[model samples]
Target: MSGLTGAQAADLTPIRTPAAPQASFVDWSGGYLGIEGSAGASFGAFNFHETRVGARAVPDFKTGDATGRSDRSRSATTAVGGLFGGYNWQTGPWVYGVEADLYGANLKRPVASTAQGLGYEGVDPAFSVIRAKTDVYGTLRGRFGYAFERALVYASFGLAGANARILATEPDLATGAVSAARRDLSYLGFTLGAGVQFAVTEHIALGLDYRYVDLGTSSRFDLGTLPGPAGGPLSTQAGFTSHQMMARLSWHPGGLTLPPEVDETAPHDPDNGDTGRFSLHGQTTFIAQGVPGFRAPYTGPASLIGNQVQSTTTATAFLGLKLFEGTELYYNPEFSQGFGLSRTLGVAGFVNGEAQKAGAPYPKLRSNRYFVRQTFGLGGETEDVPDGPNQVATRRDIERITVIAGKFALGDYFDGNVYAHDPRVDFMNWGIWSSGAYDFPANLPGFTQGVLVEYNRAAFAVRAAYTQVPKEPSNDVLDPRVFRRAGTTVEFEERHVLPFLDQPGKLRIGFFSNVGNTANYRDVVGLTQAGVFDDINDAAAATRAARRKTGFYLNLEQAVTADLGVFARFSNNDGRTESLSFTDIDRSISGGVSLKGSAWDRPADTVGLGTSMNELSPSHRAFFANGGIGLLIGDGRLNYAPERALEAYYALSLSKTLTLSFNYQLVVNPAYNKDRGPANFLGTRIHADF
Candidate 1:
């Protein structure tokens, strides 16, 4: 009935056999890149050889005769970190490779002494001081190793190089004259090391190594004519040696096929391996500006006048954590010092947006930004988000809804321009960076507590926010009462793909309103006319009450090419009341262009040009005409004119992490007063980030 006989049934029965066990050993051959931290002691010797020739032909002093010499030795402990890249090949039990590495450290020592009676009649003594420092070093090495299972022991010998600095100070005791010289030198050296590396997994390995390096000697010489026997040549020599121990973690791209037991615990994505749930990042910027012209006829408590040099420095740390799925918390702590040009007064469109009106000789530390953001996905296409400061690498739906609450800058969510937003990286003018007349809500440092919600699709997005305003005009403290007195903004954005380069462009329209204690400009002017007070500020202070100010702005950014982009912003506010926050700008229009220097073979360089025009309303202009000062700019008597400014800058990228920029600005009718002037400002900035 089954259609099978006894012999056929026997043939149909299956025979089972155990599969052969998989190999236990891993193949350790491939190219790898890693970062390492090192610590150790550096020992070095400095030899100073000095030859003095006589200035006069006499019995006691002869010309071209050797006079003095000195030699010294010192040591210092140092810590360093850097990157390493190399390739390895393994055959049988032997492994060989070539590797290169670079490191930066602070290894310094000071050598100082006094030379007695070195001058003609023993009446003059000279003091000499030298500080020797080694800042950066590198190595190119060949490695030979023996492999046993998952571990390897290796020996390396390499050619080494280092950058050294010698700072010398020499002072004459008789005349109290001092001469200083700083020399940066590069030295060639050699290195020897031995290390052991063990594979934590097929793709990751941990290594510990010790190296001894010897940097050859460098010499400094000076020839000059002096008053007496010391008029000759002086020479100094320096040498360096160091012993360093380093720990390294490396990833081998070609050796990622791991056994099942190790694969379960290994990192899923090696490129972003360390980016788990928490991340930290930081940046520092220092800018110095000098204004040559624009001196006013008279000065007020807050006025820009005369020639001045001002500098500002800020350091910030960004800390972020993922609380749960689709939710993240971020905190930014910042420390800042220095003042803007003219204590951030005089010009309506201030030259430095990074600077604050409040001046402090010491650094002031504050919590700049603290916020929580949560995203709800609406099933759609996916997009890849890159890792950055306060951003984690992940995938997100193209259509989503996001809600953010807590303290942050309003500009972070609204009124963004591609070519001109961050003063730290792009345009440095307050008017150019944002919609000047919009006067979004904020305290002294340009941030506030708020709640923002955003909805995004493939080519369109809308955002709205309600934020706290300062307790009073230009105050550093917020009102804290959410509904009683507050500020609100709504923005609509459209993104398009341009036809020329398929590049994206964006247009945003925003409306804002603030309700708080403010004075009417027209009322202040009328009170001053009625003989109540000679000063408009006095009249304004006497009539302070709750009022509302509303404004609107339009922002546009378009990419013309792969290397060129342009941006424009226009804004206006009802000038019935005094400024609640930000600079004194009632109406403004600004536009700019940014070009990458790829056409000239300097791809990392950028050039920018921009212009801004700002105007005051009828009531605001009348108040200033009657000797009223509203925050930044007021001349005693007013010859009112629109404030106009043009700015240009070139930024050169010295390295991937460092940038140097030179900028210039020309301003006409500063503070909206014709009497003030056409001012010129020159500035330089150094920015570094990690």
Candidate 2:
């Protein structure tokens, strides 16, 4: 698919070939694969009607009447991610192609509620809710474009289809109990869009595009009769239109087959000295987990259901740019989908580290981390730094001062252990991988804005940070108040030699203080017990004010031999207040051993075993005993005991940058409720980094 003539290749000399024409320098004539992320809004309307009325139906209720249907305007902001592939045929300045893409998306309309029922319905304010949602969609399109040197401007039109659903949750007026019903649909329509793409390298291109999709009105779906005497069969239909703006990155393998002489002169030559200034790397991880049937005396809103399977997937891209000496900027954008078993509830020491509080059926695109780092080097011994994600290769003095500001995860800098820190390649249990009681400040995706400063030396280091906390307990939104409501953390690190085994080891001690709009457990429980409120949770909600939580953690990692290591952690927090972030554990202690495959044969494989015991403070236990719920766990009434977890895993290396791990976890006294279960979890993880 050369865009140039045969005569042009023979006449070009090695030295002057670098000055070739734009068409030959960057080819747009081959099959390409791409990943795209989009964020925009969806607009729609849903119409609801009662097809049949029962004996106790109100006189004012009209079935299938022209003006009786509940017609509500619907709208929502949406986020989506997906993949595409296509082949392009380029003839000089003109190019033609056909492309198809499929996406998992979160496009949901707001809930429309019906007016309350009449007095004789025997229910207080009985209501019904209706909503429309789209989970997956795709487009099959043909493209036409004009090549402007390194950029291509294109337009496309095609057929579109969406997997949509209409959901309803209504109260049975006679019993005053709520139930739900849903109808799934496939909508076929049309799509059109235009975009511009620019070649960043011979094999890579970046683009931005906008599209408008129409999923025509859906057919009426009849939901059978409701549960109570005053209820009736229901039906609904909706029409949807969405506008999306997407960013894309693609790779073309055909560029790899270019003539060696020409390839060396391309912009992304491996021998270029300036290449180290910019770094781009990516990783994708998938984890599937399941639990078998277990014994349970009762189940609550947050109880883990037995005999269930679930999975989660995440894809992340890390991009870094060095602006000047000792200064760099980095961004990490990620797409995540799926949920944990029981929707990430039940277990106090959760089995999946990658699962977040917010779970979705479709992929959601988010910028999880963006930060700027500045380093000040002091004259001393120099050290070499190898290139990796978010880190550029360079040499720096052993003694230096580093400062970082912007948004990131607090775990990135604190309570880290070499043997158990990363869940993607190593352990998968939250209690084993992290200081479970630290309660670090974070949003739903486990990220927050902050500023950190560190002083490093050959043998020791000191670091501190000031960050934003959640606006309220267990909330995703961060508080803007820096001084009034914020988080501050400090850590001290010491690298030393163990006299017993003559091995190297590191020790870290961290302290954290967080101030936020949280309620006190004792206060809420007292209000609930005094007949002032019906539930402890509702009482706590009404009593929230400024409160402070403090905690500390100790982390240690030591090497026992060339192929073996051991790590441990101990963390605790004052549990008088409600949990602000993280799990429900108020005190935790964990330890583990990790062995490398060098012990046997495969040097890249590893095996690990860990155990943890998590406990809730007395007051925190009383809160749950009174039917209060924290972030991840609460089982209605208390059979209070320390939650215990045991985890083991074997990670088999498929390649230098890929691994498949098998994991197992045993959680006794889940959520610290002894009457519940000794649940067992089985999991598998596939991870890749490049």
Candidate 3:
């Protein structure tokens, strides 16, 4: 047997480097005994025929031809981990060795329907939310390899085992989600692979490899996102082999092996700074109507024959400047549209879910933003105005730089959300405000702590915002909704805590209030705002006009126990006579019990998670609770923007910068009410702050 040279001997030893935050603890060996670790992200989403925001204002029906293939994927996440050493015995000029990969991932796949049935195929508009989970907890790969001098050939026959927990794989047609509880399955996958590797130098090397891995099948988990065959027994015919043939390069200097004498000659600059950086990322989508998979009303309006191709898409760009240490000045711009499949003439397919129309494709959109990470912001925004029938209005926005200080801020800030709301001209919505405010720290002697005094003069200068509401589509197919609405808002609000009243784990006094003007609906062409499901008529628009309303909200809570609490809410409104008041204007009060708190008594060490684990917000973040309840009271903001719901929820922490929570919301005066009262159900979300 030939022994390795001095340099090769050093390379053969395990690197023992720390694993990358996003990589697995898998090692690669070279020349029969070389160990390796690589961290990179992967994109496994299958976007067969999806134009989320269409290309040229196209709608679903008018989108391209359907292939019935939905896309279920996860972007490759960068993983960090290292491998151990393994001996390679060479016989007949061939070498063999064994290797293992020890690593974990927080993988999830959110699968949704991309193609709803055409023209109301109506059999429960195929839908699903494949709460995808891909966790190959860890794998020990056994390998036998071959080596010919400097080059090596290898084969791996290993158990690609994983601890998996699948969610609504088989969804319910009625709900377009899962029916039963999660179907958890432990899978044993056999992965077969072969590759060629070469050592470029004593510290750098490269290789190429391929794999065919299979995790046996189980129940049908159709990620009904694509228009084609969702996952099932039929979809099973397609094997679980994701083929990849790539070239990779590696470098292992082993912590500056240069000797002390040579190090003295190296120059040094102990400064880490970037001149400035700019980045841009965006995706565009397009859809057209009157195509194969869409439906149009046959009798109603001949022009409404439903053969329109509406396309909607948006592209975003960002510019940033590192003004100093730990701070940046940023500017971002976006241009978006909502339809290309169906023409702006109100193609009914996307209007009523009965035939698969939820929210109308936005006729037009354009916006610009500029903000400083720890300072001031100056920017402008604009959008196409909505007109009656099939036309949209053109609106523009402008902002001047203000409040560029750190210690105290006495300037004003205006946040805006505007759109056509519908294909209605006069039925427009606009909100404007110029307000001043003062902020105080939570740790202060004066009663001013945690108190933000803000007073703004805002209202529809022209339309006088009675209330800007969102219009919901009468029906929803397989897509989530995108609302394009125009509304005017003028208001004043305040939030603060009571002095020294910080009774630990006890009653806490807080106050919040809001006041705004009422909206006028007579001019609204569709007689509905964007994202609303109001079904009246042009004639009813008059009566609904009698329904435009606005008001203020107040909430207070007190801790009763370590996990229990109590709270109350108040809605104050102003309408000429109770008769003209909208349903949300009613006044009622209710009280209920609440329970929520941190689950972990203290924090734990996560240094072993990955190399980049320290890239998060902080070393330790106290997990807090956001849960409360109040008896059925006056109707909440159930219109365009659903009210900040009052529900029973327990938010759990996942890490310093992430939280994994499961909440069960109790509907009070629910927004989109079903024949049955509000739904009491459990929902989950993972919150992460980058």
Candidate 4:
């Protein structure tokens, strides 16, 4: 529960080693399933060779490190499983054989927490989670053969290569493993196979085969997260498929032989199909305060809720393609931005180029957002109509359509909150945005199924957007009784996702709005109130209002448990108003928790409601359970019309990327509040997700 400090053992001691044991594993031992059917059936020829084991899962560095997380299998076993074996030589219409193998990968770890801000003794709040293992043999593979066994089948060809090691472990208080990372990855492969086997006699036989593994290279990692340092884009090429139904009892004593020569090139057939894929992509954060030339005195106060700067670094590259068979083409790019981002105190400000530094007005911008999307659209499988083979309707599948435009900000098109992913709402990360999304497949789980229609099948999706605001004036209504002074505001969003009513996590009903056209500025006379700042700096000139906005959104992400999960969200906004009201508006409701076990993995919990409000989270008050709407005292602002207030926090899943928090916030500004004690109550955060 405590370890790593002395400046984190002199900032990670020249990369320490040997200290990986939170819970790790990876297994392999040759022979990845073999076959050779026919004994009491009606078909002959098969093969077998299978062996796997992948271990190196030493999580719980906290609770649920990051999200691609997976632990809990301490008994369900298989830490990214793998195994391989070789041999297959048949003879009849003709056949051949040859093989060899080994496999394993590095999950990675080297974190030391508690340094997000606010200060403490060498940073109170500790860290530790080790389990680093590295091993990767010749990683080589080979397969050669031929066969025309049944009435309609035969073909296989393969080539393989491997040598891997990418490990890191950081946890030290007394010679543990300060820091140690190793990298060396390589893999080249090709395979194509077709199925049809039916033999149940002299030996054994069964059917169903499909093989397509073109590990050409495309699955690189280094995330980097924020601005400069983590590393970018790396993914050779990937296409994996293995749906086999086997049963082979062969006694290769010298009866069926032939070992060499075979190359059935269907280069991944289906009209030369190669819809490549290899993903491991990656951000949001900020903590800058009072700008103008740095006054540096721990200046605290003057917040539009949050974003004392915060642009949160940046890096992303989500790529995957399969343009046919229901459609799929998703490519998201941002290449690189700031690695670990440090403009001194944190924050990039809403995101667009982040809190200007290297020369203002728009300094660093590297936006690469590409799109041609379809995950499932267009379906009708039954081909044959040259003259009258019957079964019409050729190729009419268009269930996926995505067009993304970016200068940035629509929550970067895809990554939390527009319809809400989890915390974030502009701060000078500024302008430009466009979006489109699609999802389908359902068969009455919650009483609705339509992705076209396949009886008992249901799944649906929708998203729309427009973004670019923040030229200034949104850090707390900017005074003037609070109505309109800042600039740039026009946002619209919508979402409808529902499935899994039996409950496990799946529900979304969304709506968000904003419309602020302010800039005629000039008001403050005779102190009708607003008193000093030296008498409102010479008050005069005030009305030119046209700030109309609207808002609504709700989400429920399910997966109650493979380990644990129970999520919920609710939002409300007035955007500034020309219409709709409950008093200018700002409402919230939240509750969260998630966890997986073994050493525990994938743990998350966000709780807030009662007009809930979140400020950069990791653990905002132990997953706060709803709170925040308004009216708590004098200077307080009861959200204007309706005045609601209740906030919450509760985060626990400490590992993979770390998060241990607890906070409770309730706000009102009739100007400043008239009652209540310690500002009303609870606060804490021990967060991280990298």
Q: How well is each residue in 1-690 modelled by candidate 1, as lDDT tens digits?
A: 559999999998997778876534345678999987642222334433443233322111112223334433433444366899999887766889999999887767664333333544544233454566777879999999976545566899999888877775666555778776677888898989776665666677766555778776656444222333454333455666665556567888777433233232343342565444776776767677878865577766666876766666676888988887689999999866666777678889999878886654335689989999999999979776655677765567889999999999998889998789988877898888889898888888889998999999999999999999988888889997778889999999999998867988999999999997789998988888999887778888889887899999999999998899999999999999989888899999999999999999999889999999999999999988888887788767678899999989998875444567898989898888887878998887766565
State the C-alpha lDDT per candidate: 0.76, 0.78, 0.29, 0.28
| Model 3 alpha-carbon drift over 4 Å, by segment | 1-328, 331-500, 503-535, 540-550, 555-646, 668-675
Clash number for model 1?
0
TM-scores of all models?
Answer: 0.62, 0.71, 0.29, 0.20
Candidate 4, superposed: residue stretches over 4 Å from native = 1-273, 277-291, 294-312, 317-324, 327-374, 379-396, 399-510, 513-572, 575-690
Candidate 3's displacement at residue 382, Å, is 36
lDDT of 4 by residue, 26-130 (tens): 111112243431111111110101100111121222343322132321111001223444555434443344443343322222222211121223522332121
Q: Determine which window of 10 residues in candidate 3 has minimal summed lDDT.
A: 607-616
Which is the winner by lDDT between candidate 2 and candidate 3? 2
Residue lDDT tens for model 2, 1-690: 647677787777465546553343235889999997653222233344332233322221323233335434433434376999999987776778999999877756544433334233424332555666777878888888876545576888898888877776776655767788888889888988776665656787766555667767766565445555445666554566665555677898887222222222223322456445888877767777889999998888888889966667677889998898899999999977667778789987889998888765446789999999999999879876756788876667799999999999999999889999898988888888999999999998899999999999999999999999999977889999988999999999999988988999999999999998999998988899999999889999999988999999999999999789999999999998977888898999999999999968988899999999999999999999999888988779989989999999999876454577999999999999989889999987767666
Clash count, one per candidate: 0, 0, 113, 177
What tens digits encode model 3's per-residue C-alpha lDDT throughout 245-288? 22334454431111111122222222333122333322221211
Better of 2 and 4 by TM-score: 2
Task: Name the lDDT of candidate 2.
Answer: 0.78
What lDDT score goes with residue 612 in model 1?
96
TM-score of 3: 0.29
